[model samples]
Target: MTEMTRRDAPAAIRAIGHVSTLCGVVAAALIFVSVLITCQMIFLRAVLGQSTVWQTEAVIYMMIGATLLGLPYVQKLRGHVGVDLVPGLLPAGARKALALAVLSATIVMIGLMLFYGWEMFHLAWERNWRSETVWGVKLWIPYLAVPLGFALFALQLVADLWAVATGHDDADPNVAPEDRRH
Candidate 1:
């Protein structure tokens, strides 16, 4: 297939979008759980004079997971704010080159995150790190979310870079609101 056609390929683009959508759903669920936990913490503190020590940490981890996990979805939704002001002045080719550069930089950054996160995960596991809380949930488990999210984000960024470099815009329109997909 031609480069343009390949970039716009529905199946390929949708596959990437599906990952983003799935992550978004996970993020949403985590947010909901976090809300419930917050409510529980509030009620217990007010009425029972006690709250689970792990609640705050759990919320923090969940929020982190939600943010990282939701990144690809936000990218899919074209919700990221970009200063295209300067690019607008350039020719289409130059603009796309800039996009490619941005995507490449993103991949490198995420790759580093994934690599260091893996190292951290290994260290945490080796040391059997536990949160300083009653529940003592394994710290490593929550930290794994970092690498997982980075991996998925890297994949999405590659897809985006591929599209930009090839001058293909095969992104799904339905994934994001029409007005927002620009």
Candidate 2:
């Protein structure tokens, strides 16, 4: 890709990244809300002498949903844990090749997760599944996060791969300029 085209190539990907970041922010807010709810539940039970029923389960579900929904944002930011020793040691060409290989593998893994996650969500929805708890929330509601998050993560990976392969982005954004030399 030419410099100009390469620059423009990432516009779409950047838009998606922005959306993923928004999701991350929303996930953080959800966790915060869950924390507040838990505190309220505690105050109600301990201070006001009331029984708590839904707070615990609701918090658990919200936390799980936040985690699942945050996957794409994490991927977009390259926030996932990774050992870069091999890439760091390799020459530039080799590093680029290795990065492409790793990104391809990740795309495959996330694709599988997206596929199966959708199946699980569909099954739950079709069966009208509900939690066994007295709250009895629909199982598919929370399960939707799995497929949605995986799909977004996979897309982000694809975009990253495209950027790298097209020379629009550095394979290792974390590596300093001097360290990239042979």
Candidate 3:
């Protein structure tokens, strides 16, 4: 095949990156909301002798969304921590195989999550389930993260799979943990 062009090499990955940047925005917003709510609660308790009940739950769910949705982005950026336990001992082809296996497992896991997440969101939507707080927030409020996050995760996984399948000697996520630091 033709030598991969600049656009070819980074298309899906850049798209995933844009989406991850969006997730980063959302995560920052969620964290900001959490901080605001905490401060609000403290101010309210100081002034009015009580705070809103739903704010606590709202902040918690937002944090969860932020964290899980940001995971794939973190993975993409090499921000997440890990140890080089596997690649330390494996050979080249064996390392490639392990990389494929890793990508495949991620695909399967994300696929399963997307499948079950759809069902869960559907059930919540159909039943009009409510949150467990003073406010009657819909259950799907927090549930949105599952499908959205997993779908984005699946996209990133595909990018990873493509890089691996292309047999690139040097690619993202291909370098073992040890090779990275050295």
Runs of candidate 1 exceeding 4 Å displacement: 1-7, 170-182
Which portions of model 2 show Cα errors greater than 4 Å? 1-9, 172-182
lDDT of 2 by residue, 55-114 (tens): 998899899889988888887666799987988788877888888999999999999999
- Compared with the true structure, all predictions reach lDDT values of 0.77, 0.82, 0.73
Distance from true location, Cα of 69 in model 3, Å: 1.5
Which pairs of residues clash in candidate 1, taking residues 3 or more apart in a chain or in different chains? Answer: none
- The deviation in Å at residue 162 for candidate 2 is 0.8
Question: For model 1, how does the per-residue alpha-carbon lDDT over 1-182 read when each residue is reduced to its tens digit?
Answer: 23445556567666887898899999999999999999999998998998577789899999999998888888776677877578657765666667677778889988999899888888888999998878898988988888888888888787777655554553321122232324
Give each prediction's root-mean-square deviation over alpha carbons. Answer: 4.5, 3.8, 3.9
Order of quality (lDDT): 2, 1, 3
Model 2: weakest 10-residue lDDT segment is 173-182
TM-score of each: 0.85, 0.88, 0.82
Most TM-score-accurate candidate: 2
Query: Residue 27 CA error for candidate 1 (Å)?
Result: 0.7
